[model samples]
Target: MNEHLTDPASEGPAGGWGSVKSIARIYGETLSNPAVLETLKQQNKPGGFMCVSCAWPKPANYHPFGFCENGAKATLWESTSARCKPDFWNDHTVLELRDWKDHDLEMAGRLTHPMRYDADTDRYVEVSWEEAFSGIGAVLKRLEPKEVVFYSSGHAGLEASYLYALLARLYGNNNLPQSSNMCHETTSVGLTKVIGSPVGTVVWDDLEKTDCLFFFGQNPGSNSPRFLHPLQEAKQRGAKIVTFNPVIEQGLVSFVNPQSPRQMLTGEETVISDLYLQVQSGGDVAAILGLCKVVVEADDDAKTLGLKRILDVEFIEQHTTGFDRFVDCVRTASWSDIERESGLTEPDIRRAGQIYVEAERVIGVYGMGLTQHSKGALNIAMLANLLMLRGNIGREGAGVCPVRGHSNVQGQRTVGIAEKTKLVPMDKLKELFDFDPPTEDGTHMVDAVKGLMSGHVKGFVSLGGNLLRAVPDQRDMEVAWAKQELTVMVSTKLNRSHLFPAKAAYILPCLSRSEVDDQATGNQYISIEDSFSHIHGSIGKRSPASEHLKSELAIIAGIAKATLPVNPKVTWDDWTGDYSLVRDLIEKTYPEDFAKYNERLNEPGGFYRGNAAHDRIWKTPEKKAVFTTPDQLNSLSFPDRPGRYRLLTMRSNDQFNTTIYGYSDRFRGIEGTRDVVLMCAEDIAEAGLAPGQTVRLVSDFEDGRRRELGGLVVTQHALPKGTICSYYPECNVLNAIDHHDELSKTPASKSIPVRIEAEP
Candidate 1:
């Protein structure tokens, strides 16, 4: 829809004129449709709706305007006046709608009623909510409990996600795969292995006190705009902010706060990164090890000079294990190996290490770029090791911060939305609910896909999310999913997944985050946890998108009640009527953190879920943080072949995970299309290609299989010579479900071996 061409050189700088353009874009929609203003009024306010965007923690004193550009876009799109009513579907077929772009499908607006796909007519027909539920129940009842897969989204509130998980467990299955699989599973699995806790140790307040902030594979300006404020504050305090990423993102280079009048009027931008290092794709491990090597060498030299050693000897001796083995690894690491793998100079690595050595307090912030790889878990461990060198964890102003996506992604996991861990303890479940919850480990996202392909999994009930579109190897996944006996999607808007249904499919419409949930008792509010582990309540004041629409909580209850015979102990109806009952259940389930959940949620900004890592208390068997020594070298080796390069998939500035706000990436200076690949100028020249030439990307698999993506525009960028970059979903074809992190089982989306060929 963004028809104008963008300058191909590069994204200039974030904030300044770029932010102004974003604000103007929002007003263009708000002035034309006033409903957007209504949504903005409730966002991030006390006792109002939460922003259905990133999982960044709310400021102690919340922003008066209450949102950033991306937040505004999310609100405006959700609050649109347009609607995909029943008649609209009568004129369009699923096959036809499948051809539309993701943005166009979103522009079709909110779904107003339940609809069932008609195979004969190839269209979706309006159906009552009862009929839809009964139909789904009938199909599910005939299948084995293990045959069904319940997929949840991070966007869903705590009540709905918990109920969905409960329904799956009650139905005798543990195949509870949520969106965390594709996004933060590495953070969860990896961090737990290292420190025995998955969540970040640092709180929002830590940013203000940190003397040095290291950002690896994260772009905060676009992904988490609220973080820019603290980074700016840290800059003013003379704190050094260093960045290590494959691309030198414009957001990290500079930012202009739209809240400031002078900045808004005059384009005065604040430079963000004190040092920006463009590490190669899948090269973060090498870069970090190189920095660690410098630190070890410096400490050794200091010891020889009879000076104070840089390493935290006291902390390491008392609170950690396997340090000697890790030290041996770091000491033996060669500069040539690191330089070749990271594509960074020895001086650059030393400079970053020197900054860390001088800073008294430091924070390490990372994003998906570090997590979506075959060695993702090791990547997380490397970060932990770097911070641990100076005893940064568990101290004020210093710790590991894994930047997350979604509003309640961390919350969903907290309230029992996991596959492996049965946190609810079977004894507790029996005592409280009188139901024998299943204890067997179930499938994760990647395994779920394998189950579907093998015909072992036949039924799917999505509480939210466009799973089919969001997954890797879209074409094969789509074909495999079509063989299912039944598929049900509970969504507020129609996404690509709804179009490709199983043998029997249904789309159940639900209320948006900005709409009030008028339940049997009265209006209800649900709580969500932010990335910083703060649990807060969100109350939507706007009316429902449609009268027939139901709350996600009610829908889960309806489906559960329809599928299973009436039971007294579960109290599905009672929990749906009043969300407080759900909170009471959650409190009993996870008493360690959620005890007195309702009472604490009533507080001004909610309560913090105390992290064990924050108190320097390791939950491992050894009761100490252990240094992880990876089996493989920190750097990956590539075969000597012509035209080979590593492709890293990422999101555009105007997009969230799998949800495209628009085709243009305003911060990246990419407009009019997303069908472009960013390659280094040196590689472009080596390949004998021009700056704006067209190419077909072919992914090289270790198994000798190849995946080709055609018609991608090749644009020259300042990327590391061996690596290239492209937007996801469009480039998802290059990813295979089997290509994933061994420990976390996260699809290796960020690091794919590929080569480009001239477009024929």
Candidate 2:
């Protein structure tokens, strides 16, 4: 807090890397010895492993001063000086913590012991591990499996998530709500309809083979650092890297590679993208349609127009369906409409289209921006259709990549986390364990909140994550959470979710992947699947964040043992004491690929469990990738809500999801602030407002719900005339808790229209 020594904007533009490191640490996530040591233990090396905090997913061999500020934050968070304990929540009530800021809630520190909610005191009290597990099982056993929802987070290790999926099936609950529902649900729905699998089609190695990359709404420098090498290589090779986003992200344009010793020493940086398309929010679908139109038209004059032609007559004729209809769709779409909807003129759209046509192989990578809209699923489908037009689905360096947020978020969903997708293992479990899996699809994140509020959801056992901060409408979600009859949070830290206690609630503190895993027997190694579907072993090197902490695997096992007293075949309690037993069960219950789970995990960096993308053979009903046309192919229509501007939710460059790493957003030129709303100059004039003026966002949540948030005004970039941008979490109050995609059940986080008033 020494202002004299601080330079707010020390490493100015073109100096992104220099300022990035210290910037993130100042916000709630500071790096420490604990983080450094745990990273080292991942490699079982002397120096240290690269931090996965921000985007530090660099190659394993990337040893030369690799990692960014956010990555450092992650490492520090993993190996924090703070400790979780039973008493952590003793002084705070569910109501009290509900009033705390998101960062302040997490800043309380990691969870250290098992806890239970005391209805009389309205506080979380320390409890014996044995008591917690027994209570969890007894409550779960009493409820209809249909009424109990098991929510999993990406933070859960392979063993913990595996056990959760197994237990859910054993108890017969299809309500396996997950962190994925909030993040990549669109990718799952969209990719499955087109390619038969809800995973990225490209491998980590395939980044080298790509001739071009369409980076859609991904902030790699802030979110995922590991891909820097591949992106840098693509840039060096002249591969056309085009970025489409509402804000012109500086990280996507250029970033310094901390791994490059020469670059760091000389203060040099690498340019990332060749083209920057500031597509208005929710305009991705339109922008993509524009490209499709150009490709279909350019086919006629490929040579003269110098277009990257993609007729692919032979492939389209044999491999895909609805090509004729799709082509017609492109032709009927006029340039004026495309320009109006996309906010990019004919030349920019053409230029983007030219890059697509010129490259034989194209990879489309996206983040939450493409997944959090009303038509998010369709947006994904549009990308798939566009890729299919050019035969890009199965080709090398030509596929879709959804850069996942949390470490094992995708892996958890892939292995077992599913409330809806009929898992084959559930039937297999009934046959093996003699319990019928629940038939009804259970609650999603938003649905769970509603169910809790309605008193239909009696109990919740979350394996990981802070559900309170992560969900939409904190005010409503907290109210709903308080209504639950029983809530059990199996966690690594103390957070707001614990505050939403029921008559019986528990916060079971557990080990972090960045630290060594241990049960009664010995140390254990956990597994995580990366964005590229690479399953790597992550072992913690640091001492426990808290000595009283238990691994998530152990706690779940305790619950299983406590709940299923009549289980004849399994010794759930015995396995609860040791994680390796959990891993063994995982290898047995799922695919055979995880058979050599332990030994293979220690083999340097780790290996893949096999992505269907590798062989170009999909797992569709036809044994070939299939394309699906949505029952409706219409774009979003802003209904006549008088005086309302198109309000889009945005993550400040300094923040990630609900995790506020800092208040400063270096990218958009905002610093020491998180409350500012980004607006166009015309809107500032139209509203008769000045740059630094304060305003209130008046929202119309279709169900007659309304909210007002105040913030400073920022008039900078050229946003589409009707569109306005504001930070998420702050603006989450505007979103309707009941509104979401009927299928994916993802909250409409990106496109909610609102009206701005002068702090009324």
Q: Which candidate is the best by TM-score?
A: 1
TM-score between model 1 and native: 0.97
Worst 10 residues of 1 by lDDT: 1-10
Model 1, stretches more than 4 Å misplaced? 1-8, 26-32, 635-640
For residues 1-760, could you state the per-residue lDDT of candidate 1 as single tens digits?
Answer: 0112122455565666676676567556534266667668668777788888898887657777778777777777777777889998768889999899888887787899999988999888999988998999999899999999999888888888888888888898888888889989999999988888989998977887999999999988788887888888899899988889888677778788878889877877788888888888888888999889988998999999999989999989988888999999898888898887788899998899888999999999999988888889999999999999989999999999998888898899888788875544667766876778888888899999999889999999998888987888788788888899999998878788888889999989888888889988788989889898988888888877789899889999989988986668889889999999998888887888887888877455557889999999998777899887755544333453677788888788878777787766876678889999998788988899887788999878666767889888988777888788898888877888888887888888888878888996
Error of 2 at 760 (Å): 4.8
lDDT of 2 by residue, 284-376 (tens): 877888888788877878756876545777667666666667777777877887777777787888888888988888898888877877778
Single out the weakest 10-residue window by summed lDDT for candidate 2.
Answer: 1-10
Query: What TM-scores do the predictions have?
Result: 0.97, 0.91
